[model samples]
Target: MPHPTGPRVRLRAGTRLRTTLALVLLAATLTVGAVGVVGVVATTSTAAEAPRTWVVDAVDDTSGNRWDSVDTGTSVVTIRVGDTVEWQFDRATQGHDLVSLAPSQPWETVWPTALQEYRDAGGPSVTYTFDQPGTYRYECSLHGPLMTGTIVVVPADSTNQPPTADPVVEPLTGPAPLVVHATANASDPDGDEVVVAWELGTGGAPTYTDHTMVEYTTPGTYVVRLRVSDSRGGLHVEEFPVTVTGTGGPGTDPPTDGALPAIDALAAPAQGTAPLAVAFSTQVTTRGEVHPYSVGLDDYPSIAGEAVLVRSRGRTHTTLSVTGTKPSARHGSVHVHEQACDDELGGAHFRLDTTQPFAEPNEIWPLFTSDASGASGLVEVTKAVRAGPQAVSVVVHDPDNAARRIGCADLAPGTADLTYSWAFGDGTTATGADPDHTYATPGTYTATVTVAHASGEHAGHATVSDAVTVVVGAAATSTPSPTPVPVVDGTPPRISRVGPVRTVRTSRPVVTARVRDAASVVSKKAIVIRVDGRRATKVRWDRARGIVRWRPAKALAPGRHVVRLVATDAAGNRAARRWRFVVRLR
Candidate 1:
């Protein structure tokens, strides 16, 4: 049904409940005016009071007619005393009457006679002038609680202007448990004293003060609001946003020049055997200020006393002790099990067990952690585990709270703690943990295998057969030649025709070389060219033709340039050649 006074005031669809509570509170604080219908009269004054008109639209829909306006949108409107408000009713609506619900009148009292006339003539609109400075509550008698609004009337005097509030927040972004300083600059035109209150937009009891400091325990974006009210009841508000990063501890310094903390260098032994204990170290550096750093192992507890508090741009080295026991032999085979955890001490675990059920036993290593940057550790390998191909990896959880893999390093075969290379003495060599080779021509050949241990300083060689003789005889008519056996190519690539030892020019000069191997070149990346110890840009390699070409992207600065070329074949054999050339600008 349409409200008699026009349409009922409708709250936004989603906020009906909140709007109702707010209107009830507003009704309790407002003062009701006299409800009798009075004749409109023009008052004479020394200066003409030009009346301002505000429109309260009466809209029609399936439910009924609704009151709408910028002020009606929020269920309240503000106006100076003596300003006029027009309640324009839609002609097609019916049964809606604007009634005063304030203390001075009953809920059923109809307001302004123009509304009554509008019902009869289908054209009359009602206008009301507020003469007193106070809040008045009104509603449509027919629609009851659903149709309601408030009018806040202020003194017309210019001296009653509201205070202006300006808020300032310092060090807006930092690590969690961030401390933020907030202050407001507020002023009232009438020189009235103003009270300032602070509110955290996320929710809490407001703090009353002009300047205050607050701490945010969790990492997120928060809004800090300042409300300033003058003695005359005029109010103003402003808000400032603060961002808290989650990278480090609360005591950590905020970023400057906007750079993040990083792991500079990590050093550790690449391989280890069973019953191995290794010490690893890494340097953590920050572009700006520093904070506390920690190191932890995958399944083990964090090194309790290893936290370092950094305050400047210097690097801090953290050491970790790791030990791995020999794998247990089961069913004539060895099995090693390892696991990684989410945190230093607790959380989910990453397990690696090759002998879980029906699976074959494999070698596994535990991962490690060092803050959010990187981690390092060691795993032991026994002769049984080394007999076959195995998979190994180092895993670290993501620092951004993403419960997934952060960093991983996969270990492959032949990259273990020990390597063996064999020389057949027939100008052919093979390399692997265990390799086999067959001589093409029958003759006495010396076969020797050199074992290179991970401990760089230790290596050993053993003669498998000093002189193995083979005699070739006429083959039977139907007999096929012995199947060829594959052997590892141990010879490195050879480099030839390197030049332009010296050149004077303004343009970049190209360095070219012909590299070859008895077997074959590895790939385009097999050849690397460096100028002045730095990898040269725009390197091109023709693998089929064994041609390597490199040219600097920019013109060479006139000076002595050292060019070095390193080439490797398919079998991991590497050879390097260097040249010094002088370039002078023309």
Candidate 2:
């Protein structure tokens, strides 16, 4: 084995003393007699030596805590060779790993030398062997001062066994303060296995098998305790009190405590370039309660005007108003904020916005600008009550954010009765209870409406009328019947090509033909045209114009071809036309 035999390699006093102590401690055996190691009794009460596991916490690396155990430096551990040392990186700010550095100890150094590679791939920890007996020293690479741990690798023949673990109780107040975490610090004196569990109550109630920590979702108080056991059922238990208090639960009945104010609805002006009205409602649960609010468009801030507090009988309500100047990019959400609350220190919040260039299916869509009950700020052009020319109505409601519409603003508190109408283009007119319209002619025309409200001088004309495009249904034209020629001798007719075809392209292919209907000239239904004895597919017809076309099954060879045409009209007459012509291919 390699040995350190040169001149007394003197290290700094601090470094040398620390290194000497570490080496001596590593060589020292834990089996040595100790005053505290006496009179320790082993019990089998089913709760004394339960095995408890802590996620190898990585936080111990920088917390000045060894082995990332708890908030403490000393860590108690026991395992056989090849056993894993799990290091949990739970909230640990430093990245660290284990290394075994000891003079003249090759095997011990083997694991630590390769620790760098393993440290990169953090995990519970790497396994090691006890083949060569000795001690191990390791430290965190990221934060050296904060992280350090030692392991005493004992052979299978140690005389002094593990010491009996003392029961440690951490006292608390009441309601069993939330037990976010729980672990057993007990161990077996005989190196026996430990199994940890919780003893719910007396009379030996069934204990929990998996040691999962429990938590409370609500604020409360309770009696909570922990129990530990050894392999032989020896047990130990401790009870502690805890209390929980914080933000209350979700509001159930119209928060009698904290309430925000409301705002009114305003519409953008008719001018193409004008600001939009900030339509928000307000409310307050208590007086002297000032709630700050602001509005904005597309990330641009808008003045939220001023907040006015008012008293209603015994309660309180505030009104907020704001406006948006500038033509916003079509279709976007407006943001509204509820600054603070009276009763609740943590003020609540919400948003208010509108859509741009809204459209409707088949009607004179309206330009909406108002705040009404049930409608919010959603504007639509619906069908009218009476029908003459097309009629449309535009309805707006409070922009109900969060689907919450309590005592915010009574747009139409009970029933939203506010409605307006508009007339579509075309002389045809109609009136109804809905906001919809229909056109009389099939043309693109500008339709306009003048809306008048029942309450207040809420009247406005949408001169920038919506466009209406009416479509006419397809109609069939009349066809003149061809007079049939008298038959003399029954002879098959011949069909020959005349003028050049428009082109070989499918979009526009035109071929002319001369047809001499043999026996009797007949107006026909079915026509069969064959190219080289094969029938053509996808034939088109224009009965009134006496024009018919036969798109070839496939492009013909650039040569001459023989073609045949046969037809049978409604009458019991048939004709066959056969001809030959030079074929063209492109």
What lDDT does the true structure give each of the candidates? 0.41, 0.30
- The TM-score of candidate 2 is 0.18
TM for every model, in the order presented, reads 0.23, 0.18
Cα lDDT of model 2 by residue, 1-586, tens digit = 1211111112222111101100111122111011122122231212222322222354432112334333222332332222223445444432334434343222222233333312322333333333323345455422222244444333333333332323332222223234444344556566677555553222144345434345544332223344444543233333332333332211111222222222111111111111211111111111121112222222223211112222211122222222222222221111111222212211111111001111121112222232221111222222321111101111111132211111121111111112323344456433322233433233443334322333333223211112222223223227764675864554544343332222221111223344433234445346676666887766554342233455443335666666676766544456676666554322
Compared with the true structure, model 1 gives a TM-score of 0.23
Clashes of each: 7, 72
- Clash number for candidate 2: 72
Worst lDDT run of 10 residues, candidate 1, spans: 18-27
lDDT agreement of model 2 with the native: 0.30
Q: Candidate 1 lDDT, tens digit per residue, 320-353? A: 2121211121111111111111122111111122
Error of 1 at 230 (Å): 3.0
Which runs in model 2 stand beyond 4 Å of their true positions?
1-56, 60-66, 70-82, 103-113, 118-125, 161-586
